[model samples]
Target: MSASLICELCPKSCRIPEGEAGDCRVRVNVGGKLRATTYGRPSAVHVDPIEKKPLFHFLPGTGTFSIATAGCNLHCKFCQNWELSQRDGTEMEVRYQADPPKVVAGALQTGCRSIAYTYSDPVVFYEYTFDTARLAREKGLKNVLVTAGYITPGPLRRLCKVVDASNTDLKYFDDGAYRRYSDATLKPVLDALVIQKEEGVWLEVTNLVVPTLNDDMEMIRKMCRWMVKHLGPDTPLHFSRFFPMYKLQNLPPTPVETLLRAREEGLAAGLRYVYVGNLHGGAEENTRCPSCGKDAVRRVGFQVLEMGVRDGRCRSCGGKIAGRWGA
Candidate 1:
């Protein structure tokens, strides 16, 4: 009989028997070797607006070719893309056999400015994302990571070499709330975010305010304060309004007022750029300059209506706005 082994990719450090997979359901132990089974097999691929990655700062008003395999490290109770994230590679109905080269080619053909390793967590599909991002970088395309930030620093540091930007889901400020709702710990995610920042990866943070769970203004204040202290005031913070889904359907959708409140808290805590997401056609969707208080970039949902910034600086006052905004 083959011996069992542990997968040390994520903070979970799941132990898998010879015939079994890790908690992510993609890393399988075969003959005592851990293999990323879905390395080249992607389950979802699309040419999406960079804004749809909810990346308001990096390369706004551009197309991003997004891809994902079928696995995730964290099992968040209110996953919006649960059907895709909460499944293994074998369970996907639309698995694509596209290799790294094919994925990069698709992005170029689609006229995308960047490639997004999103939908599911990229940590679970590390090899695929890393390979594709490397190739994409050589071809002059940027790489974006939409992740939960629940990864080990070693892997995250390596990934930051090829990746250009990230929209890390912060989830909650309280450690107890993180464990209770997401089956994950808090410190690892926080550490991952700091590593990304230190690696020169353009970082943006998103918080999905679940009603009565993590929507407390005090917790939001703490999260913003932490970001300002560690990630700097220029780091963009997105407050997302959660809709009832997956295992947390018993909870009501987050009120718009609550999202607005969270945004205010983040800004009040000294964050330079704060946005309210998942709600369209609002003033909070615009990127306001911290120095001049001008709307640096205006957007309605995924559509960019105006660009008031040039060369990553505010046009009105020439204040430095943080992002990768050039060709």
Candidate 2:
């Protein structure tokens, strides 16, 4: 790898010197060319319900083979998975090294319908994700991206080609919120969301309502409004509860009232499917028909307790629900 290897995968655009790594601490200038240090070296792997990704609109009750390497582009103050996402290249204890073909085989062996790139920011490990997604597609396994949507367009389009769905974190509506707390900007995420939607990927957006930082009611309303305007009113929005974690551990857990209020705001903004996450026993977690307000998808924890769709239409009003059901 040469000292002048330019890394433009993400917004950081680090031009690495010899033997140096990018800001994410995963892509290194090895020999001369930029190489992904986490390639085939996964730190975490698990099988989880797609709902665990908090993606209600995408393969709702299906199980997915989820895996991730250790690195992240954002320096979020309230990152729940910071221990893995913020590690240096050598810090991750590689429990297994599975290449794209092995990953596809593993998903098939587990009878997983989809493969999820999750647990950490996939944007930092674009090459690995791209390879695995391509292989997963060839094996007839659906690809899903549980991401922060922080990558540039060129790389994002490449990944989106093989991705069937995505759950992108729209952290905050304000650019200042991102600039101050996450060391990123909001526009790129918004752009990526629009791009993913246009590229025909089933897109779901999540906003973690932190105590004081992004819990502002007005901002939440604005976020919902923007989603409705750009991504359409049928786009599902998830209002997740934020627990105290990492650098922002001083604050208390986000109030249930806050989550409910944000959900209300989203519906008020004309978005059809709005749900609350990271909390149990909430009535708002279930999906309701937009036409007749019928309980279409009954959820208990991550389990699909009951389903009320007949031929993908609501049982009550027969209105079409926006998702791939019984496919």
Candidate 3:
């Protein structure tokens, strides 16, 4: 029998016996080699506005060709994409057979400026994302990642080479919440975020405010303060409203007021670009100039009404806005 192999991609470091999979369920020990079974076989693919990634600052008003395969490193109880993120390839009924080159071709054919490895944690499909990102970059396209930020340092540093931008789900600031809710730890996610920043990947953060779970005001404030100190004030922070889903269906949806309060806390903590998401019909979705207090990027639910910045600076006050604004 082949020896058991260890999957060192995430903090879990699941050691799988021969012919078995790791904690992520997508990576398998086949012939004693840890291989991604979902590589080149994406379970979901679509064209979405970059804003849907809730990435307001990077390449605003652009369409991203998003793709996701089955499996995720963390098992969040309230996972919005649990159907794709929490399942294995065999259990999934539908999947598309598109290799890295084909994915890049589809993005180019569709006139997308970037390809988002999203809808699931890209970390679970690290090899796939890395290969596709390289191919996409060579094709003059950018790569974005919407992830839970649960990866280890070595793999993350390697992945950052091709990843142009990322929106990492912070989940929670408290270690207990991470452990109890996501079956993960907080420090690795925090470390990954800092590494992404240091490696020059355009970083954005998303905190899904699950009421009664991680919506403590003091904890939120501490998270904001950490961002300012480690990632700087300009790092865009998105407070996404969570609806009861997956394993946590008993909990109520996050209140809009709770989202508002979180946004307020972020801004009060000196973070420049704070946004409220998931719930629609509010001005919190728009980007305002931190200097002049004028609207810099006007939007209505992923549609850009106006671009009030010139060369990445606010046109009203000529203040610098932190994001990738040009092709």
Candidate 4:
């Protein structure tokens, strides 16, 4: 009998016996080797606006070639993309046979300013993301990661080399809340965020404020304070309104008041850039200059209506904005 091998990609450290898949469902143990079965076969592929990734500060007013394979390391109870993220390799209805080279070509052909490893956590498709990102970078296309930030340090530090920017979800400050809500712990995610920042990746943070779960003002304050001290105050922080999703359908949608308060908490805690997401048609969607308090970038629901930034600085006051405003 073959011995079980450990998958060291994520904090889960799943032990898989031969012929069986790991906790993510897509990675399988075959012939004593762990294989990413979904690699080179993206189940979901699309050309989406960069703002849709909610990466407001990075490459605004541009499209991104987005791709995701089946399965995610963490099984979040309130996962919005559960269908795409909670399945196995074979369970996907449509798997595009686009290899790493083809994915890079598609980005160029589609006029995408960047390639986004998104929807499902890209950590599960590590090899595919790294390969595609390396090729995309050579072709002058930026690479973005929309992740939950639950990855191991060694692999994450390596992945950051090719990745240009990331919007990592900091789900909860409380470890117990992470376990109950996402079946994951908090420390690894925090570590991953720090690693990404330390690796010089343009990092943005998203906090999905679920009512009665991770919406405590005190906890939000702690997270914001940590971000300011550890990740720097200029880091963009997004407080997103959460709707009842997947296993959390019984829970009511997050009140707009909560999201607003969370944004306030983030900004008050020395964070230079704070925005509210998921709720539409508000000033929070715009990026304001920290010094002049003038509008830097204006948006209306994924559409870039106006840009008050010039040469990566606020045109109104010439204040430096922390974003990769493409030249």
Candidate 5:
């Protein structure tokens, strides 16, 4: 009998050969069994505003119970959450022994409408996320994911069945850029986005604009253009500012001008909803009606300052806005 389980959860498809681990370093083969070492073991947990997920369209103004285990599929040098994402399960330092039922109870006790699998790549903690999502769904609670989207199609299909929405980090548009910096590829991510959208999961994209890495105006335009073509103009795109962190601390934070310019480029590429995040205040932080050009959803630093979307339509011109709006 072989200890390896023929790992195929992500594009890496790391073949663990008896007592070895996958690229994620958490999923390992132990005595002829493939097991997720971090299953039912969490390193981080919080009750966060749904807007903090940066998913404006899915259940706005609501609270979410967020949880994460250790390890990530990608090795992005500029990873903001690298302390958790880069470590193996044993090196996590903090741990919570929780199962699906406990996760559901936590969300209910916290008065959260959804549970988010975030902080580290959810793909590495698939068993935990899947079990929790199943329980959450049975309890009539929603599930959201904040992920790197570096996954294969089979597991992604299984995940989409339970996840109601996701905020996938696009990272960069260049395959060379991804391979060089993030230690991943681009096509599989695009495939995951398309599948999630097709599977009826509300999807949003976030691109962290590192100072000199992925903030090229031409590249930004190209990325936006592809989004408009495949994901539609209505899909919300967030151009988040990056500060020096991890291995890339030598460079200064992304200039405000660069973020604003990228926003403009996205708009020029015919993207209806473009946003700038990680900055305190900006007009691009608000959601405006594409047809009426009126502020549909207003925000002041992740707080919903005002919501002019009446039953998912613009209050000013009665133009239909794309997003989930529930009373």
Candidate 6:
């Protein structure tokens, strides 16, 4: 009999017997080897504005070819894409049979400046993302990851090589909230953020303010302060409004006022860029220069209305904007 294989991509480290899968459901132990079953078989693909990734600072107005396979390492109760992320590829109804080369070709065909491994956590489809990112980089396309940041350090470091930018969901400040709501811990995510920053991946943070879950004002302030101290004040922090979804349907949608308050806390904590997302038509969506208070970038729902940045600096104040502005 073959010995059990342990999947170490994430912190779960689930030991699986042959022919069975790990906690993520997509990684299978086959013939004594752990294999990513969803590799090269993405279930979701779309062309999205780079801003829709909520990646305000990285290549602001460009389109990103987004892709995601089935399965996610963490099971968050409020997962917006649970239908895809919570299931295996076999369980999913739609699986696009596109290999790394095909994916790169498609991105080129679509005129996307970057390829985003998003909709679900890219860490679950590590091998696929790595291969696609490598190919994309060779083709002069950048790579972006929209993730929960629940990856182990070693794998994350390897991933950082090809990933040019990322929007990591810092779900909450409390470990208890992580354990109860997401069936995961907080420390690894925090560690992953630090590692991504150290690796020089343009990092942005998103916090979904779920009502009665992670909406404590003090906790939000603490999270912002931590971001400023560790990841630096220039790290763009997006405060996303949470709507009832998946298992957290009992909760109401986060009020706009709540998102505003979170933005206030983030800005007050010295975060240079604080955005309110998932809610539309507001001043919070615009990127204002921290030095001169001029609107550096104006947007209304993923559409760039104006650009006031010149050579990665605010045109008015000449303050350096902390992002990859080069096309």
Best-fitting candidate, scored by lDDT: 6
Q: Scored by Cα lDDT, where does model 4 land?
A: 0.93
Error of 3 at 219 (Å): 0.4
TM-score, every prediction: 0.98, 0.97, 0.99, 0.98, 0.98, 0.99
Whole-model Cα lDDT per candidate?
0.92, 0.89, 0.93, 0.93, 0.92, 0.94
Compose the digit string of candidate 2's lDDT tens values, residues 1-327: 244778989887888888888888989898887888888888888999999997776677888999899989898999999988999657866647889888888899998999999989889878888899998888888988989999899989878899999999999999999999999999999999999999999999989899889999999999999999999998889889998899998999999999999999999999999999999877788999888887999997798888887677898889999887755
Better of 1 and 6 by lDDT: 6
Ranking of predictions according to lDDT: 6, 3, 4, 1, 5, 2
Candidate 6 whole-model C-alpha lDDT, 0 to 1: 0.94
Question: Distance (Å) between predicted and true CA of 121, model 5?
Answer: 0.9
By summed lDDT, which 10 consecutive residues of candidate 4 come out lowest? 318-327
Better of 4 and 5 by lDDT: 4
Candidate 6: regions farther than 4 A off: none
Show the colliding residue pairs in model 5.
3-32
lDDT comparing candidate 5 with the true structure: 0.92
Clashes of 2: 5
RMSD (Å) of each candidate, 1 decimal: 0.9, 1.2, 0.8, 0.9, 1.1, 0.8
Return the clash pairs for model 6, or none.
Answer: none
> Which residue ranges in model 4 land beyond 4 Å of their true spot?
none
2 versus 3: better lDDT goes to: 3
lDDT of 1 by residue, 66-118 (tens): 99999999999999999999999999998889999999999999999999999
